[model samples]
Target: MRLIFIIVVATSLMPISAAPAQAAPLDVKGGYYHFIGDEGGDVDVTAQAAVLRNMEALTQYRSIADGSTFPGWQKEWINNLGPGVDRNFVLELNYYGAGEPTIPRPQTVDGVVVPAPDMTIQQRPGDTWKWAYGYRQVTSGQVDPLLKRALDQLKTMPYAETVNIQLGSEFDTDHEFGTTENGIAHGWAASDARALTAVQYIIGYFRSHGLPAGVTFSIGMGGWHRASFRRMHPEWLRGDVQVLQWNAYNHGTPRTPYQVFNRTRAWAIEDLPRWRTKEVVIAEWGTTANVGNQAVWIAGAGAAIKRINTDGRGFRIGTLTYYDNDPNWGELMDRDAGLEALRSVYTARPFIG
Candidate 1:
């Protein structure tokens, strides 16, 4: 009688959550993905993963950014997560900073070397730093020289499989185009338009090279911001966007906040579908500070990445990158065990087969 009772109770309890899912292999047609940032899972495979390196040529100069300290500055992971690299891991093509930042070292024109301060180099939200100062140079045609230099260097490096630009985190820091009050997702901001034009040039540049054969630009928003943009910029929703992502940085209180449970309900169910992006993802999400327990929370978030039913084709979530802050912000994984969560997710991250 006791055994029967115990067995019945165990079976009666329902599963709290499902294990995190991985993305499907993306083709020209586009389908399911698994960089499940919504659930805090990722698809970073060091060998097969796409790591963004700094364009040394650009950062070598200091005016654009302190070549020695800022820009591609790499840092130690919270738990010494995978291939220990510093904070300088952004996909920013270096060598373009014949003046201050990025790589590939462009050639001189008219005996002058200046990294056009107009071209924008985007970073995650709430931070300061950019590719250029404003659209002043972009419209002046100064970006042409820098663009030429960038194209030259990109050709020599390892081919980037997908260049995913998860938009919306551009929450107006001191960067050039981002300085305006217009929300990053506003879409009508002049600076935003210039950035779009620049990105189009970048896509055109790469497509001409045959490396990626195509280019993908991604954008994301949190529940709060998503509502604002949807009402303000209804036209922002379109079929052109290849990768649509979501931000899941559940922050505030206790330094590092526990996410998963809330995210499953928020990102998976509410936010993703409301945005109607072709590919759904939690582009950036992680707990801040807290050491010993970070691993569990991070992994839990991954496991909790629940899938939602939609009308479009079925697909997995895309990458869920752990947001690592360089320059040692108190909230970052500077010297703690928080990285274990990040490592576990990537280690067990799903593949696109």
Candidate 2:
């Protein structure tokens, strides 16, 4: 049987008059995993189903970043599988380098090399390989056109209800196409004015076009200050936007977990109050723990959930979507055991009681 778990705030923490079931589920926490590839040529239906079955939410770039075959294929996938999944489907728009090369590249349209100013592709020799193979550029402006294209494609899809247009992810990283010099020229670089402007433009575009309701911007889990972005636009610092959406991959540092948790709490409790009223979303989080140390990782995760849930300051986090069977993060699942463990945590009622 499918397991369903609910979390309720304690009686002392909430008003006596409030209904016990009124407490909200932990807000926007979820997992980031690769579900589509190569224009959906080799679709992994089974694996995709397994992930959706296990996760509360998922973030995907199939229709945005790579459009060659993904747009049609993803639409099909969502149509076939989205009905049964109870989680949210956060669709990312390519506002970073994911769109650069595709943006109206100057090419021979009619067998004659003509300078198409409308075609804005400025190809660097290594950019394509870097994007496809490395996946490292953290900030890239090439995404603007790509985002427009993705939105257009989404309008044609059959499963609009299963979609949430996420403006961008991990804008603070250096590897992002938006942070580069080219990205800066395209208007995705790190000025508070520029970032805010871009956000407003995206929001305005979505609203004007009548996009779905679940659309929103997703900042990474990296502490706001640690984000390379803060170095460029320090004035945007507000106390209300909690930045805890990225992963805390341990690189063998003994104190990494402790430090990570502390930083997350500090931002949720302190930094967020100064910004807009936004809740924290651990949009992506996982540790690269080997099989021998899985217990330690699990314990650490449990502790994190307990601490965040029980904090008296009312800075409550919404969700804790652990990384499931990703190979990049040391492949948490050797077989199906990791799924079993995840099911246990997701269904357990320890936090509610």
Q: Per-residue lDDT tens digits of candidate 2, residues 1-353?
A: 12322233344466766745424333323332433333443233446446434444544443234443223443455455554332223343332223453452332322433221221112343654122111112123333454455567656655555444433444443233343233333332333234444554555555677665544444432443443434322335332122324445543554444465456456444434443234445545555554245535544554565455555454345554454435555355442554555445544433233
TM-score of each: 0.51, 0.61
**How displaced is residue 21 in candidate 2, in Å?**
11
Give model 1's clash tally: 41
> Where does candidate 2 stray beyond 4 Å?
1-54, 62-65, 68-75, 83-148, 156-162, 175-179, 182-193, 220-244, 254-262, 274-277, 290-292, 299-303, 324-330, 350-353
Off by over 4 Å in 1: 1-133, 162-194, 205-211, 219-224, 227-240, 253-277, 280-283, 290-292, 308-316, 326-336, 347-353
| Best lDDT among the predictions, by candidate number | 2
lDDT of 2 at 127: 57
Query: Per-model C-alpha lDDT, please?
Result: 0.37, 0.42
Poorest lDDT segment (10 consecutive residues) of candidate 1: 53-62
